[model samples]
Target: MNAKPLKIGVIGCAGIAERRMLPALVADPDVEVTAIASRDGAKARQFTQRFGGDPVAGYDRLLERSDVDAVYVPLPPLLHAEWIERALRAGKHVLSEKPLAANGKDAAELVALAEDRNLTLLESFMFLTHSQHAYVCEQVVQGVIGELRTLTAEFAFPAKSADDMRYNPDTGGGALTDIGVYPIRTALMYLGSDIEVIGSWLHVDAARQVDVGGAALLGAPDGVTAHLTFGMEHAYRSQYALWGSSGRISVRWAYTPPPTHSAVIRIERQSHVEEVTLPPEDQFANVVRAFIARVRCGVPSGLEGESLLIQADLVDRVRARALIRPAR
Candidate 1:
């Protein structure tokens, strides 16, 4: 017998929810988006009209729905832990957007709540669900890259809009919390969560009162090192490289590749180069499937909670250590 589709509700009608997440959820056979809610009822109604879900007046109303088996929280970082806690208390499984919380303490608290309730609470690190990353991990583990020595990643884009939430410090907005977390998490995925931040620098837009860009150097006691650079205002760049003793692996379009874009992983060793091109994948859909599998089929989330805590802690340390300079 086939398992039933998981009924889902969305807590916010953010751009990500409308552009990327809704389409991915709608395309998945294992999910049924039962409801959508936004602070603006009209926006919620419009989202439902386009996305195929019941329109709820507010988030609390959506949480009160008996038919909503799970909720996807796409709120900003500052609001993630609050609504995630509310959704869990309302007896709904949750898949929250990344940076799970503003800091490590809040993230740990939410994880504990989810554990206490036995609900599947997943942080939406959609890129990690993509096959390209899996292939890279497998190749590295099997010594295709030999013993790992260093990792370098950069994710940045120009966000010149003053109204963009990423420029608002009160909203947990900064390069470290926004784009920086990607490289930090990717480093942890390969180098383990025991890494420490040894050196850091940040550029802050004093007028905007937020971090626009920064670089961090992380080192594991075992000698593995990761260099991460991220920003919200800069030339477009999203990629990472893994440098090992024998060979090196590089991934292009590492973080935000579209569902239909082919991913290329380049391997170089001994004056020879090989390229592994992976077919398009809907990572958001994969995340939904994984969430359902864990919630309904009793599959585990595989140490994501611990990794989230580590990521949050490292973000805190980086922010604390970095020398902030006013952006010109």
Candidate 2:
């Protein structure tokens, strides 16, 4: 028999879903959007109409639905943990956006709940779903960058606005939490465990108290140093380069650039250079499909407490070290 359609609800009908998730999901043939919620009732209704889905004013209404097998929690950073826990308690799987939680403690709690309930709680690091990242990791393991010595990645996009979610301290706004997490997590994804934040610095707007941009130095267990930089006050820039004893590999437009959009992966060996074009794909769809598969086949979710804990731990440590906190 064919599997039932994966009934899904979306929270936070704001930026990321409207721009990225909605379009990607609507284009997906495997999933169904059952409901949507937003703090603004009118906006929620309007967004539901726009996206061709059911509309509810509050997220609680969506959570109450027995048809919603899974929920996509795209709320601001501070809101992730609470809603995720709620979704788990409601017996719904969750595909949450990055940073996992407002802090490590909350993230640990969410992980524990997901574990106790045997629920699928995934952090939506959609870029990691792209094949380019895996390809890069393969090259690294193959010694394309022999004895990986260094990693440098940067993500910078112009500030959307002071009122934008990225600048709202109450919503967990900061360059580190926003874009810096990408490079930092990317490093951890490839290098394995024993990652430590050696040192860090932040440049903040005097009035807003939000970090406009920042940099971090990470040390791996094997004597590799990764330098990561993120800025929301500048022009668009996203790239990563891994350097080692024998060679270096670099990816331009690493994170936001679409996989099928004709990006080049350059591998520089001591003697020659090799550039390859990566396959294109909708990574968000991949994430959704995975969630649907797990929900349908009675299969286990790949996401686990240890992984979420690691991500949360790193993000929490970075925030603490940099001394960035939400405004009162």
Top lDDT hit: 1
TM-score of each: 0.96, 0.93
Give the least accurate 10-residue stretch of model 1, judged by summed lDDT. 298-307
Error of 2 at 113 (Å): 0.5
Cand. 2 TM to true fold: 0.93
What does candidate 1's lDDT look like per residue over 1-328, in tens digits? 8888889999998888888998989888889999999999999999999989899988999999999999999987788888999999999999988878988888999999998998989988888888898899999999997999999999999876778778878875788887899998888888897888898999998888888999999999899999999998789999999999999999999999998999999999998999989999888888888888889877765435676787789888988889888877
Q: Among these predicted structures, which one has the highest TM-score? A: 1
The true-structure Cα RMSD of candidate 1 reads: 1.3
| Candidate 2 lDDT tens digits, 1-328 | 6666677899888688988888777776777888898878888888888787788889999899987888998898878888988899999988898878867788889888987887778888877777788888899888777888889988889878657877778886777787888887777876675788888777787677678788888888888888888878778989999998999999997888753586689999988999998777778777777666666664544344677788778877776677443322
